[model samples]
Target: MDERVATALGEAFPERAVDRTFGVGPSWNGANETVGVAFADGERAFCKVAVAGDGSRIARELAVLRYLDAERSIAGPGVLAGDPDADLPYLVTAPAPGRELLGVWEDAGDDENAGEVEREALLRRVGATLATLHAKRFETHGEIVGTDRGGGLALDPAPWPDVLRATIERTREIGTSERLADHYDAAFDCVEATRGRLEGAPAALLHGDVAKPNLFVSDGDGSDPAVGPDGIVPIDWELAHVGDPARDLVRAEDQLLNGFDSEGPARYADALYKGYRDRAGGLPPGFAERRPIYEVVRMLGRSGFIDQWVTYLDEPLESLVDRADAELRARLDAV
Candidate 1:
């Protein structure tokens, strides 16, 4: 129970009394804090108080929630109060329906083969949701409020390839190491040298971080007990941006089906792609050509942030980066 939670809630919901609160979220490890709260008046809202480094994320998420709820019929959290510029930036949102998809996944974790049908069904819905989001179009790829999306100078949209290159470059800087930066540089160069492939990447909505923790499932507004196509609701839009949909799809697969190692059978990914195709009428143009490129780029970005993903490394940063380099080369060759 961090004291910041109460402070942010008090500021946001001065009218209601905050009560019975506990920490919630994947990053509750101290860097960023989120709490599920129940007020004295029987109302509930999710609270997120961003640490200094996470102010922009909180701001972006608040804006994204407003955009989706107001403009799109997406059934995700709605912003109740926000102070993006506050000393400890924070936002409060009405609890969207359904349970966290991670919990559902965990119930089937002990046995990978458990609930195979159920698991694939959920993945299909996740895919359909992605298809639904892809419908929200933008002229150029970049931030939602970018000049391309008709906003002030806060963000300015650019070509898809340009944004992809910029993201890889930024990730490299943020995750640089003398021992590994060189290998990382090679991966970046390959992507740039073959950047012509990205021309087919479309400027579409991307649910920046499409991990299990960010998805929700419910029958409906507490009306029934069934999880189906419309039951799928994705939360956490802080990373949401206008970018290549293929890049987004690959990242989603990384979290949903496989990671860098890619050991497990990609059944979930297959179902997700099928659902996406069924909804979109067909896969995007040049999908086969761009998928691996985006996967390689995603791997490079993940390689940069070793500390964040070290849990999966099971080895020193040196070995992991060595492995990342090899993986990058292999994926590039496959492309």
Candidate 2:
């Protein structure tokens, strides 16, 4: 444990003695850096601390959780207490139940038929949860958090395009195979062509990162031994913002398609559209036309040459860049 974390916890709850416990389970989510520690009272909680000056991230997360807590419609980790004044901004919350959907999907592994069935059910649950969130009157903590009247949270949109461009440049710089090179080129072109179209889309409250890992499931103890059907609990609202709803939906769709190999891309893509429509009432105009472009944007946004693809591939950086270039070219051809 970092000495800073221990001291911060002591200050936050001055009356209680804090002991580090090894028996506590590890964190199952990826939203932020949190240490899993069991308190002396036998309560298991996650301790999330941010450096004092970097309180915005923790503040934003706390605000979202507080807003959700008030609504009481969705299942999320309940915030126990938080303080931003200490050397570390800290929050303690009861852990929510569920296995990360990515792990579940991976465990289902190459069992195609079984994976497809499970994936569909998971998709429906996710769709329903999202629908509930979107249906609520756009209110949060009784204040409008954005320019829109819906009270959705706001974030500067200026960084997204630059973020996308930097991702592409990084991938290209890393270098990869001919095939990936082609794909990267094609993806870049698609981005350039459709960038203008997305500018006009209406902004709504979006779960900034809606990938599979953030969707969790818990199982009920029963003879059936299957995962509970109440639906997935969406975790991590740190990136929640008033932005293009399509960005959120498309991000989820891309994860279901490209990130998971259990089902064919087109099949999963169709399933996502169906799920989104069931909740949102209808697809946005030109949804089909815009999907390919959005996929490119999402791919670029997620590509971290050093952290994810290149390191996982265990190849030379130049080779990784080459592969990305080829993949972009191929994706562009399809577009």
* C-alpha TM-score for every candidate: 0.84, 0.71
Q: For candidate 2, give the lDDT of residue 214.
A: 69
lDDT of 1 by residue, 1-335 (tens): 57788788777767778668965744613445788898888888888887654576676677677666555535567678988788888988877677888888767545656667678887877888788778766677776542224332145567777777666664564563445556556666767777788765777777877888889877654333223346877887766777877777788878787765664457877888888888888766677888887777777555666555566557677667667777877887877
Q: Candidate 2 at residue 262, lDDT?
A: 29
Candidate 2 at residue 198, lDDT? 50
Top of the candidates by TM-score = 1
Q: Using alpha carbons, what is the TM-score of model 2? A: 0.71
Lowest summed lDDT over 10 consecutive residues: which window, candidate 2?
139-148
lDDT (0 to 1) per candidate: 0.71, 0.57
* Candidate 1 TM-score versus the reference: 0.84
RMSD of each: 3.8, 6.6
What's the true lDDT of residue 176 in model 2?
Answer: 31
